[model samples]
Structure formats: structure tokens, C-alpha cells
Target: MEATHRVLVVDDDADIRDLLVFVLEQAGLEVSWAETGEDALAKVREHQPDLVTLDLTLPDMDGTEVCRRLREFSDAYVVMITGRASETDRLVGLEVGADDYMNKPFSPREVLARVSALLRRPRLGAPSEPASSVEEPAPVAGPADAELDVGGGLVLDSARHVATLDGERVMLTPAEFDLLRALATRPGEAWEREELVREVWQGEFIESDFLVDVHIANLRRKLRRAGSRTTWIRTVGGASYLYDPS
Candidate 1:
């Protein structure tokens, strides 16, 4: 449970830091703090927390950059906390790999709830090797557990947590893979964003429609970058998305 989890709270405001630390600690979780992005990176490297509460306006660097850097070495659940409550700010934060985010003036209980919900899910794995590094495609093995080789140059193995496109490994974030798998498992089915949130997050978090959209955008981009011959996913009249390997 989250009570046994480790969390790093990164914010320049000492009062906010103290408040978050107190709330998290009261819930029986080990907590730490950092005032700068550099310190946050150092702390993450040293301690490897299960979750991080990052302030978007860090004195040393932008929270998006911190999250981008953190994604390289760790997949800790990042909750970008910001004083700005604009859609553009949320988009930027989500673009950099924040699993979730919230605006300022939030209740500590909500943070704890979000944290508990996030920690309940599997950690998004560390980022894969740079696209330039792979010299050759690894040969695909026999049919895998819960395999979904639906043609169209994409293969998803749910049990093994792998996705291959055109016999080459498709670099995918864990969220992207989960979303792809959910859609691929039931191809041709229109999945509303809310339904995807439930499928991917297992109904642990709500009000995550944009999170689904952002990750879906990322997934489609990666699929194209990986050389899919055609669209493996498509949107349903701007309302939802579905897997369409044709």
C-alpha cells in the first residue's frame, strides 16, 4: 500500500513543502523534500522514490524539464503541482511524462488520494534505449502470452509487457502500451476516454480524459515513428479513439 511507499516532495515554498510532508507522513509514508530541480534530481537519483510531487515553477528549472530528465532514469509517478491552472500549463506538464497533475489551492487529502491511486498501478518502466541505438530488430519469438499480433506491423504481448512494430521493438511508455493493448484487445470497439481511464488506471483515478488524449497522441506519434504502414489507431468522430489496424 501507499503507506509503505516513498515520496519526494519538490517545491520551493517551505510552507507548502511542510504541509505536504506532514500530510504524507501522517498517512504512514516516508517523505522527503527538495527546493530546486537540481536537488530534486539528486534526491530522486539517490533515493528512487515511488512518487514525486513536483512544483511546475522551480527556481532552478521548469518542472517539465525536471520530469523529462527524471524520465530518463526513473519512472516514478510524477504529480506536477502548479499554481497556474491553465490548459496550456497542464498540456506542457503532461507532455513531459507526468502521470498526473493538479493545480495549487488543492486539498492535501486529494494529493494523498491521487498518490494512493497512482501507486496502486504498476510503475511505468524506465525509458528505453534511444531510437538510434538499435542496430537490428530483435527476432520475434513464438506466440507470446496474451499476444495480439493483429497485423499492421504491430504486436502487443500483454503478459510480457512488450510491443513490436514491423518486427522491430516499438519504443512505448508503459501507459502508451497499456492504452494500445486495451484498444487492441477489442479492435473496432470505440473507447470513450473515460472508459480508457478506467481500463488503464483500473478505475483508480477519475477525471482523466485529457490524460488519455495526451497519451493517445503520444502513442500515435510513436507508432508512426516506428514505421507502421497505416494508422493503428483512429479517433471516433472527435469523441473517442479506437484501434483500427486496417
Candidate 2:
């Protein structure tokens, strides 16, 4: 028998909390709610949920900060649901470790849909225990073709949910790891943004082109920070991204 999937809903508004809880519970998920950032963090630490729905505005702290702090200890997928709809806001949200972003006045059905998409696709490379979060920075290299064992000593261990650079662990989000695996598996293959969306995200959630760009950019930043000496992943055109081992 499979274990029940758990979700935490964090919003300052009681109505929104109730709505999300009701919707998720109706969908056969075990749901929890928190009304403040600190409480949300506490609940996450305690529950070790599979996902979190977070509002950008919290009474105790900004939602982005909450996410950044959460990333320190938990890799639970986060969806930033807020009234802020600016490009800057969305980018910042994603940059801080949010897996997805949604504007306010959203349909409950759409919220359910995105949540369902995320829940359906747990970390493909998660470990036996939990892919809860990335370990301390051991950044190394990217993957290569065929078994992701190429790219100048970059190796990916899918069964273990780890990618190593010169044998150093390169911490990656589940999506980031999947993206690297896709590129590394087919070195020199230029994938259009739309195609990538389908490839990585399984084409289940409705998303704009920027979603791919943001994730790719995040992947790049992490690799660079991990002391990568080469730009392994590159853009071929306005709409295509590829991994080039050479």
C-alpha cells in the first residue's frame, strides 16, 4: 500500500486556507494549514510534507524569505500563490526556490490542477529516505551522454538522486536534476522551450514560456556557484536550450 501524500497550505487569510484545505481534502490528500511564516516552517519541519502552497504575504515574514529559509532544510515543492503578478516578483519567487507561481484571484480548480500536477510527479530521482533537501555545496560538473556519465567527469546517480562534479556532490532541485539529465542524456541536442516544457514537466500543467527560462536560469546559477569551470548548458537560439559537452 502507498503512503498518503501530504500538503501544507500557508496563507494569512482564513477563507483561502479553508478553501484550499477543503479542495485538497476532497481530492484525497491529507492537508495541513498555517497562518504565518513561522508556523508554516514549524509545520513543515514537523510534517515533512510532500508539497506546500504558500502565499507571498505573511504576517511574520515575506513569503520569499520563507521559501529561502525552507530551502535550507526542506526541498518540499512550493507554489507561491499571491496577488503580486509582476515579472520581478515571479522571478524572485522562483529564484528563492519556489517550484511554481500563481497569481491571486485564481480559480480553485486551477490551483487544484497545478497541485495535482506537482503531486503526481514526485522527485524522479529521490532517495529511499527523502530527497528533502540538497546537502551542503559540493558542486562539481554536469552529466554526459548515455547514463549521464559524461560532461568532463560529471556523473548523475539517478537511483541515489545525486549528481557529482569531479566526485563532489552538486546539490540540485528535483526539477533541476531532471533538466540536467535531459540535456546531458542528449548532448548537443537543442530543445525548444515548449518541447522542454513537455519533456521536463510532462506537459500537464499550464505554463508560459518563461517557466522554462526561469528553471534553466536557476540550474545555470547553481552549476556556476558549484565551481563549474565551463558553461556546459547553452542556448542555441531565442527558444532553444542545449547541453554541449564540447
Candidate 3:
């Protein structure tokens, strides 16, 4: 039998949590729900879900922190749901490594669609093979000479989705690593916000462009925490961003 797609739904609101569990289960996915970030993390480690629907506001910890923490272990897909409509919130969520975002009072259908799109995305950071699967494995970093060398001190195992900076392993969520690789792989190319959204988030379409900024901010924070330099992702005009390999 084919493996079931497991989804972890995290929200402080009981109604929203239950509603998502019902809707996602009805859609044929194996669903689990958590009322807090701590609970969500425990369940995530236990179940190892295929995808996650996370509310930006959680009781124990903000959704952004949750996103950062999860990246340390699992490579599951994350879609952040926020009650605030502020650009800062959207940007922050993305920066913390969310794969996608949805503002509150959102349609269950839209939420379902985003979840489906993310789930359908090519299985990232895996070796390439036949093209029959719904999502292609993330492109590998092989023996190419022309590839951006972020630094000889750092090695990114793209296929396995791991990064080692200065011989010490650092943790990143799948989304975080993808963002880093997208920027680092090119090294000096100026990647506009729209370009990052399209390239880093290839499967699903982001409705608001500001979402890119939030993710970039989050990526910078995490990389900084890992003691890696993020000067490579240069911001331009408060509108666009680029990667400087130099």
C-alpha cells in the first residue's frame, strides 16, 4: 500500500484546529492537530509529518520560533497561517522558514489548496531519478566547477539537505536551506523578490510579494545564529534582493 500523507495542524484556537483536522482528514490525508507550539513539536517528532499547517501566533512560542526550531530536525513542509495582515508578519513568517503563508479569515478551500500545492511540490534535496513523481527532488550540488562556492569553509549537501559551516553542522528547515542554496548557489546574481518567490517557492504561488521579505529576514537570522555570514543576500531598494557570491 502507498504511504499516507501525514499532516500536522497547529493552532491555539480549538475551533480552527478541529476544523482543519476535519477538512484535511476528509481530503484523505492522515491528520494530527496541536493546540500549542510545544505540543506541535512533540507530535512532529513523533509522527514526522509530510506537511505542517502552523498558526503564526502560538501560546508557548510564536510560529516563527516554531518554524526555526523545526528546521533543526525535520525537513517537512511548513505553511504559516497568521491573523495579522501586516507586511511585517508575512515577511517574518517567511524569514523564519515557512514554505507558504495565509492571512486569517482565509477560506478552507484556499488553505487546502496551498497545503496541497506544497505537498505536491517535488521531494526536495534528494538525488535525481526518473520524472514520474509529483515533486522532483531538489537539484543536487555535484562536481560542477562553475557553481557558486559560498565558501570553502562551508559545504552544502543539497541532495541530503544538510549544511556544514566551518566543519560544524548547522540545522535548517527545508525551506530555510532552499532559500540559502538559491542565494548561495548563484553568489552575485541580483535576485528580485519576485524571482525568489518564484524560484525558492516553486510549487505554490505567493499572493503578496511582501512574503519574500519576511522569509529573507528569517533566513538571515538563522544563518547569523549559526555563525555564518549572510552579507551575500543583499537587499536592494527595499523591493528586491540579490545574492553576491563574492
Candidate 4:
């Protein structure tokens, strides 16, 4: 039998918490809940859940801070829940390392669907091998025509879900890595926003195009921090984004 995926639901609203717990439990996941950001962090540390449904406004601290802190040690997927529907709010959540965002008054079914979709996707980190194994396994090529060398000392190993710049590993969120991999696959191809959403998000419905932009921005930031001097991912102005390594 497959191991049960764990979820940490963080929300101060009693009704919302109960609703999420019910829906998630119905989905066959091991669900836990916290009423504050501090408690949420504690639960995360203790349980090391596979995913977290975090409310942006928490009594103890802002959810973005919680997300930032969580990213320091955990790569578990985070879906931010916010009462505010502003683009700025969503972008802030994404910048803080949230894998997805949902506005207030969201359907319980939609929330469950998002959770299910996220859990179904593979994470970026590689599994550890036995200490006695001296030889490294050969890198496997992805469907995008082998690993992409995006110049500027950047290499994307899709098979191992690893990205390296200047011979150093570049830590990326699962969403960022997927977006980069999708663009790098067909360099210079201006992929439409919808197409990218379908490809990277696996057909999950995103309410706004800003979701893509936010993830793209995060990807660029991480890549630049990883020591790449040139701009690789570029916007096409009213069209799409392309991986232009020129």
C-alpha cells in the first residue's frame, strides 16, 4: 500500500478549519490543523506534512512569514488561502514560496481538487542513495529531448529534477522548476500563457494569469541568484514567454 500523504491545515476561522479538515479527510489524506501561524509552524516541524493549506492572515503572524520560514527547512507544497483577491496579495504569497493560491469563499471541492493535484505531481528533490554506493547513476533524459544546457553556466537535469549554475546546485521550488523546465524544453519558442499553465500546472485551472507571472518572476530571481548573468526567460509583450538564452 502507498504511504498516506499528510496535510497541515492552518486557519484561524473555526468553520473554515472544520470544512477543510472534512474535505481533506474525505480525500484519504492524513489531516492536521492549527489555529495560528506559530502553531502551524510547530505542527509542520513535528509532522513534516506533505502539504500545507495556509491562511494568509493569521493571528500570531502573517502567513507569508510562515511560508518563508517553512521554505527554510521544508519543501512541502503550500497552498495559500487569502481573503483578499488582489493581484498584489497573490503575488506576495507566491514570492514567499507558496506553490498555489486561493481566494476567500472558495469552494471546498476546489480546495480539495487543488490539494489532490499538487500531491499528484512529483517534487523536485532527488532521493538519497545508499552510503555504500560509490558510482553515480547516469542522468535520465526527459521527454523534452534530453537535459537542456541553457548556456550562461546553467544546466537543467530534468530527470533528477536538478538545476545547476556555475557548478553549484540551484534550489528551486517545484513550481519554479517546472516552469523553467517547460520553457527550456523548446528554447526561443514563445509559449502562450494558457499553454504554459496547461503544461506546467498539468491542466489545473488558475483563476488569473498573474499566477504564471508570479512563478516566472520567482524563477528568474532564483536563477539570477544562482549566478546566471544573462536573462534567459523573457516576456514577449502581449503574447507569451520564451527561453531566450541569447
Question: What order do you get sorting by lDDT, best first?
Answer: 4, 1, 2, 3
The list of candidate 1 runs beyond 4 A from truth reads: 1-3, 124-151, 157-162, 202-206
lDDT of 4 at 90: 83
lDDT of 4 by residue, 76-191 (tens): 88999999868888888899899898888989667766776666555544332221112222222244324668777788876556788878998887778778877887888898
Candidate 3 residues 1-246, lDDT tens each? 133578899999998888888878776778888989999989999999888999989888999999888877778888888889787787767666677888778776766666665564434433322212334234423432222346746666665666676777666666666677777767766777766756666444466366666666666666677786646578877777776534
TM-score of each: 0.81, 0.85, 0.72, 0.86
Error of 2 at 228 (Å): 1.3
- Highest lDDT among the candidates is held by which one? 4
Let me know the TM-score candidate 4 reaches against the reference structure: 0.86
Model 4 clash tally, residue pairs: 0
Quality of model 1 by C-alpha lDDT: 0.76
Residue-level lDDT of model 1, residues 194-225, one tens digit each, is 77776665434346777888888888887888
Where in model 2 is the C-alpha error above 4 Å?
Answer: 1-3, 124-147, 203-205
The lDDT per prediction is 0.76, 0.76, 0.70, 0.78
How does residue 83 of candidate 4 score in lDDT? 95
- On a 0 to 100 scale, what is the lDDT of residue 78 in model 4? 94
Candidate 2 total steric clashes: 3
The alpha-carbon lDDT assigned to residue 82 of candidate 1 equals 90
